[model samples]
Target: MQRRKVTLKLYPNAAQSARLEAWTRLHCELYNAALEERIDAWHKARKSISYYDQQNVLPQIKADRPELNELGSHALQQTLRRLDLAFQLFFRRVKAGQTPGFPRFKAAKRFAGFAYPDSAGWRLMQHGGSGATLRIGTGEAAMSIRARGRHRFGVEAKPNDITLTRRNGQWFVSVTLRVPESACARRRTGDQRRGVDFGINDWATFDDGRTIDNPRWLREELPRLAALQRQRARKKGSLRFKRLGRRIARLHERIGNLRRDFVHKETTRMVRQCAILATEQLAPKTMSRSARGTVDAPGRRVRQKAGLNREILSAGFGMVHPMLAYKAEEAGTRLHLSNTRQIKPSQRCSACWELVPKTLSQRMHVCPCGHTAPRDRNSALVVLIDAFNTQHTPGTGVAARPKPLPRQRGKSKSVTRETPTTAPLGA
Candidate 1:
């Protein structure tokens, strides 16, 4: 799906800027008022208030106060939509066992300007030099930079008040445009299927024994980040402190960009090479919660787990899987999400079917049956096997058995008991 986002450099004159701010404030007021009314009605009648009821009354209210009409009917409609979204979120949270509360008024620090339906076509007045004239209402405002490169044109501009705002000295503008989709013909040549295991020490391991190391960029940058934060905290509300805060925010943004770039590259490479790709469905949030601990009295195991989670999230494993799936479809490749819940891929030996008890610290899969391999690679092999079974003989009810491992080499021979069945791989 194609999506478009346009950022405009607005240069509204003083009078126009004030008008725009006033319009935004009025929009926020109408939104909060509608929300309060709905909440009060729900409290008194024990029933959900509908958006239709609010929309039906808005036009009459605007007619009584003609000044409200200047804020644009479409802008008021957008506010109602926002209120509806808020109410939906509240009910969803309540249904999920969370505390629900009334929607609050929009504060200045977080205020967003209004949106209006396109009716009158807006004009971008091209001018000489490095700037352009943006005509809004009866006035023309000159911007410092011209819209060039692949920047979107044909945006129906609204009143200056609907443009961006300067918050804490940073400027922003919002413009909407329709994006056209470009199709590419799919070409398929690969005949192999690949299974990937995502981990902490390594970003991904394939069944073919290839591995990608975890960059751990966040961990590496933590020391510098902590130092900057400490310095900023010491300055309190000073200008230097704000600058440092901005620097820290920029650093985070940079790291996020880099991580996203890496994930896209890796996912694209895999999708292009394999005819079928299989991977486990991991819950990053749950994994993160299980890894929290104090640094001074930190549990190595928990810290390691947390590190793995950070790596997984940074690599965008969850996002990459879906992206790869869609890209593969576009490329005539098949993407399969293996039923990790039924297979003990990590513990079950891929070759001899022995049960190998392994801790997170263990990097090697060494079975007493003389089968030795890298832990992730071995796990990937089992994942591939599971994928094959799922594709070929699904519901045949042939379960994997964890056989006893043979005696350790150069050690006394002892009887090994078969391990009990545990929860499946991805689960």
Candidate 2:
């Protein structure tokens, strides 16, 4: 059994919407209050507060604040659990020699939502189609919400857990259910092994020279986004300003949805087609790091670098690797990631195995050995070559290819492109 989470967009009437907002506010308050208790206990008496230590006093808290009773105990406990997890992560990061950002109190608006740990507080009603009805709480206090979304697999087992989340004024219920692995398996339609290169301009470039054009969603929406920002800047605390903020939020939500939808579809395409996949081990965080140096020495091309970072982030290429990984598991496809820094696929020649450095603007890969192709295609080839026929010699950073490997049985064989081989001509 695999745990699959299905998120459904919820449609609620005015009363239901009000109730959700109230519960969300209550959960946020509980989280903040619990955080305060931990801080005070630690500072005043040098005492550390555990989750159960705070949980044991919940009954008294509910009694003191009767309003919390309507929110359900399981959901309230999950809020405390979230805080405990936050602290746990902080401690773990500290022990790992990383920055341990202490947990800060979240405003009610910042608190997205809350979770129910188990079947106690929620129930899902499936009607065979894509849609379902989610019932929260029980008896007279039960709030039945109409959920609209498509489920990939049949959810027959009891719900593992339920989380109610609010994103940009929209309510979503993500239900985790235990489903059969067979039902979750992806169907493969193609047997070709391929390497993929993700880019900021183009979404993906395959070793075969086929390109999936980048939607450039953020770029297309920028004009309207800029206009809205300009309007909001003119009035800091006005009714029109608040309305503009909501409009901006809705636009952001739309952009996010478009990106997610495209990613899922494209990933599914790869999962269904390729039997073996190779890609670069991209580090988006390192690539998009700020270029602003300290006062002693300032950075060059700050605005240009900032714009490049935005483009890198907007492309959402980092999501491809993880998406391919999980989808590979379901499709029985092999996924390999070549070391980006060491291999330097973008610079290394796939044919001669020599370094062929080129500027970012130069989209064509041209080598002295008469090997040439699109830069991205060559990069994908380098990645694929590294995955199969090359290995680095000990104590040396250079990778050595013993011999040429057999080509993949792909749809279109490359007659024009040079295959990565160390063998002599006509050998």
Candidate 3:
């Protein structure tokens, strides 16, 4: 079965909203109390508290605090389990020689929300005309929230888990459903294969000489954001401060949403059109690292580097690649992450397969062999050709063919040796 998650915005009445907040607060307290217990136990007895030990005490805990009994048992258990997982991660990191961040107490704001491990405690209902509803809790404690989303899950699809979260004063539920893999499978076959070069000016340039312009959403909103921040700075602790704070958060969220939406649409279109996709494997973290130097030594182009870092982050190549990965898997498309060091897509000419050094300021690629093209597009073509260089023979300029497919009992199919068709870099 394939697992898919869909988040739905929830609209709860005043009473229900209050109850949800109360539930969130209780869960926050419960999580902190558990973390405190572990710290205390380890400090006093030099012994670590295990998940099973905590799980065994839940019955007594509920018996002592009757109020907690109102919260579903599974939800409470899940909270404790989350604490246990945190500790497990901490210890794992310690063993791996990484920073072991011990689980700390959570403020109500930080807790976000809780989850139901299975469909037993909650139900999702889809009405023909009235949209969807999420029913959480049981009997008297149960509340039905009007939810906004297309009901994509079918009757046969089972809800495996559900999390109710509060983000920026808004309630949302993420439902994880288990459905047959075949149901999620999309057979998208095509002869068209393409490569992409990612950049700051154009979000991506394709080998076919197509480009998606970078929106620079954050850069565009910076002036308005600065104005709001200035207003907020002057109105500290006042209602105006809180209002502006929300506005700032919403603006940030809007920019993020816009970038995500743009990437999703572009990636989906690419995956649908091509059977195989190729692009340079880039480490955005290393690329976006700060150019600041120590107290004694100053880095060159500090301000310029900072500006470039912001552009890189706003571009969000990290988010784009992962999104493309899963989408390509579902669409039955092959995504090839070419090694950038070996291929050197940006430094090599796609047409003559010759080294052509260019600086960041150079927007066009010019080769001595009379080959020229837009820099990013030329790089994308280099990546495309490199994708087919299976022999890894440097400067071969020969495109390898796809391996022959299997034969069926009564049908004969020719092996496809057709390579990716791209325009000359100069063209």
The predicted structure with the larger TM-score, 1 or 2, is: 2
- In model 3, where do residues sit more than 4 Å from their true spots? 128-130, 151-153, 187-190, 391-427
lDDT of 1 at 219: 78
**Which ranking of candidates, highest lDDT first?**
2, 3, 1
Q: List model 3 lDDT by residue over 1-427, tens digit each.
A: 8788878889999999999999999999989988999999989999988888988898999999988887888999999999999988988999999989977889997789999998778999977643798988888878889998754446667778999999788899998989786677545645477889999998888998888899999999999999999999999989999999999998998899898889878888887777777787788999999889878997889899999999999998998878777777777666666666655789888877767888999999999999989999998997777666642332222223233213312332212222223222221
Residue 157, candidate 2: alpha-carbon lDDT: 50
- Please report how far candidate 1 places residue 82 from its true position, in Å: 2.3
Query: TM-score: which is higher, 1 or 3?
Result: 3
lDDT score for candidate 2 against the true structure:
0.81
Pairs in clash, predicted candidate 2: none
Using Cα atoms with residue i matched to residue i, what is each candidate's TM-score against the true structure?
A: 0.70, 0.90, 0.88
Candidate lDDT values, in order = 0.64, 0.81, 0.80
lDDT of 3: 0.80
Tens-place lDDT per residue, model 2, 1-427, is: 8888878899988999999999899999999999999999999999999999989899999999988887788889889999999999999999999999999999999899999998897888876676788899776789988988767775455579988899878899888878887887888888777889999767899999899999988999999999999999998899999999999999988888898889999998996887767777888999999898879999988999999998898888778777777787787776667667666889988888778889989999999999989999999998777655432221212233454223322222121111122212111
* Runs in model 2 lying further than 4 Å from the true structure: 156-158, 390-400, 403-427
State, as a TM-score between 0 and 1, how close model 1 is to the true structure: 0.70
